[model samples]
Target chain A: MIGELELILCDIGNTTFHFLIDDVEQKYFLNERLPDFNETIYYISVNDNATANLKHSNDDLVDLEQYVNFKTKYKGMGLDRKIACIGYDDAIIVDAGSAITVDIMKKAKHKGGFILPGLKSIKDLYPKISHKLQFDFNTKVNLDKIPLCTQDAISYAILQSIIEPIKKIRKKQQIIFTGGDGEFLSKYFENSIYKKDLIFENMKRIINANNCIA
Target chain B: MIGELELILCDIGNTTFHFLIDDVEQKYFLNERLPDFNETIYYISVNDNATANLKHSNDDLVDLEQYVNFKTKYKGMGLDRKIACIGYDDAIIVDAGSAITVDIMKKAKHKGGFILPGLKSIKDLYPKISHKLQFDFNTKVNLDKIPLCTQDAISYAILQSIIEPIKKIRKKQQIIFTGGDGEFLSKYFENSIYKKDLIFENMKRIINANNCIA
Candidate 1:
């Protein structure tokens, strides 16, 4: 762990093409601007120590060692999972955004969580099925706290599905919530915490796990 | 009025299927069984009067008299509004079922209400748009409480949409909750009351409005 940035972190989720560079301040940049039209999620991170124009392999994950041409070795890993498991040593982590996700790790046993549709996902559905609903949520409408109707129902349900499972699993356990919808979830639980800078923290964890410095 | 039935009721909503059988007891019968999709909603008070068929044309709703054929009239009148109007000389009616409807009648207004999807409607939308979640609900399952999760959020949001608007529009006005999901909503308000057979009640009102059986 004696270099300035041992490994780069790549994460792909809702919108693919995410790359994070581990740094002491835990600063990292993501390419969330990728077009959602691609069928597969592909990304790679080059080791600062080695050189050989790094690129993603045919498979969804990245072989960090092969990509960077590093002398030392590490197996291929999924970008989303690696990024998710980055900061914590032993804890349950959830990423609820466009799609709600729950991932758990205890004693190195990988127990997966669930993934449901995200909030805005509804707006994308109705028009295809029936033009009548026109689930257009962006129509300059102010939704009430309790929600008065269909539009509010859409937002409320999306938020509920994402957070409820975490509540049941968080007894005597630490829960971390992140994603663009973090604020929506934080409203439900007073004890739970929200982290907007999860990508940066993920980079830090990946660096620490590999005994690399950033 | 020569009819033995003292109460004349009518019910109507998005679908106009109740022709005109303006009896309070009959209205009660239909509204109570609105969700009985397994059986046909048509009922013949056959023995009540040998000629009840040829002369009845929905004995209660005269407004719908122009479209006659007493033997079968469930398809004649304004569907969701009338029974919601019945038993009330003046008030606002809210039917929260497959869709949340808010109809207002200051007595002078013929029909007034907006249509929006209900809890099931929202749930149905989720599974279609969401790759993972599939909507499933049993007719036997009835939720009278606010849901803390996605399922509840959907149910509550749709319910609230109906309740809150009715609260805002006519202060101290009687808010009548009806339709398939009526039970769940009646519990929400101190000012609200529920009518199980809205369309049936309206059918009777239409008959009386038409001076069909008085």
Candidate 2:
């Protein structure tokens, strides 16, 4: 809890607007109008439209991108991904949202990362290839064995494909899973931590560091 | 060579009509008219439109789906995948065309398989998710390390995701890489055989067994 900071934090993505106020979390769709709030909202957004909407509203807004001073060699990295890595010094950060962004943080600096189509994106893609390929992923799929059926096969390919590279790259570091699908994906890994409010927590850290309680 | 058999084998996919005549391979786009061949062509197709087109053509065609006697518990398996596993008694058959189908053939019996979107499908998907993800894959990406750039990261995820599962399932069995992308994906694996004519060779085996050289 960010005691006495009295900060209302917002993390906006392509689809949803996530807000945390007075230690209470709330979510709103991007299309919906911004909620009327009395407190100033400090926010980071990857969506330009959302940022624009928030700026035009009568609410007090502080764009937090200016407050982040993280170091990384990766270019064109998403703002949400950058903020998520703020407090992690040595961890593999897997943000599984509309897109899964896997980044490596070492010695409190960004070591770079990769992006994969999220579970929903992958699910939507299969049927576009062929109707025969259309099947829901078996979420409880056994990744250790090669699947013999179509459903399990698709599930294995989707899950194992994402899991293997993370396993390969992880060496003596705890994997931190965040974002929407993070909980579902974290089940397959060992020595991993799932923190849904990772971004918000880091957002609070940034606020504390900058002392931007104005 | 299908010596003395004098057979013309065709493999029809969604995009191309692949023909092997007198051991000479030729390819024609699906939109183009079928070649005016004199010899009777034996073929297996996963594309309904192509199958219908060939049926309406003047060319002599034999559908080999009736001749296959393979055993598997998998339902709704594509005819193309079934035929590709014809002669491989113990191998991981990877047909890397528009869709990469990985099947295990054990003792000349089907043990079922899984499917992944081909490289092109994967390449096309990234951009649809985000404009930042629109970069072309680094074909020569080093999969051993976590990539520090966007291009290598996407490439590693795409390539390693596919490779690791195939390696995991393969135990003392040869990995047979076929289809359009077969030769390219084969470079990452050791003790893997790239058989461009795998489906055609298997088709010939079916022809020999059935003695349908009428």
Q: Taking the candidates in order, what DockQ does each have?
A: 0.07, 0.67
> Mind sharing the TM-score for model 2?
0.92
Predict model 1's lDDT versus the native: 0.45
User: Which regions of candidate 1 fall more than 4 Å away from where they truly are?
Assistant: A1-8, A12-96, A99-117, A124-132, A135-138, A142-200, A203-214, B2-92, B102-116, B129-131, B134-175, B185-192, B209-214
Candidate 1 residue lDDT tens string, B1-214: 4246444222232223333333323222322333222211233221223223323344322234243232211222223344455556456677766555565555544234444446565566656543333434333222343232334333333334344454545656667788777776677667778887665655544555565553
lDDT by residue (tens digit), candidate 2, A1-214: 3576677888888878898888899898878887678779999998898788877763688888998877778877888889888878899999998778999998887888877778788888888887778787788877766677888888888887788778777888999999889998898888898998999988888887897776
User: Chain B, TM-score, each prediction?
Assistant: 0.53, 0.92
Score chain B of candidate 1 by TM-score: 0.53
* Residue lDDT tens for model 1, A133-204: 344453333333333344543444334334444554455556667876765656566565788668556554
Q: Which sections of candidate 2 miss by over 4 Å? A: A4-6, B4-6, B28-32, B35-38
Fnat per model, in the order shown = 0.04, 0.73
TM-score of each: 0.45, 0.92
Clashing pairs in 2: none
Worst lDDT 10-window in candidate 2 chain B: B1-10
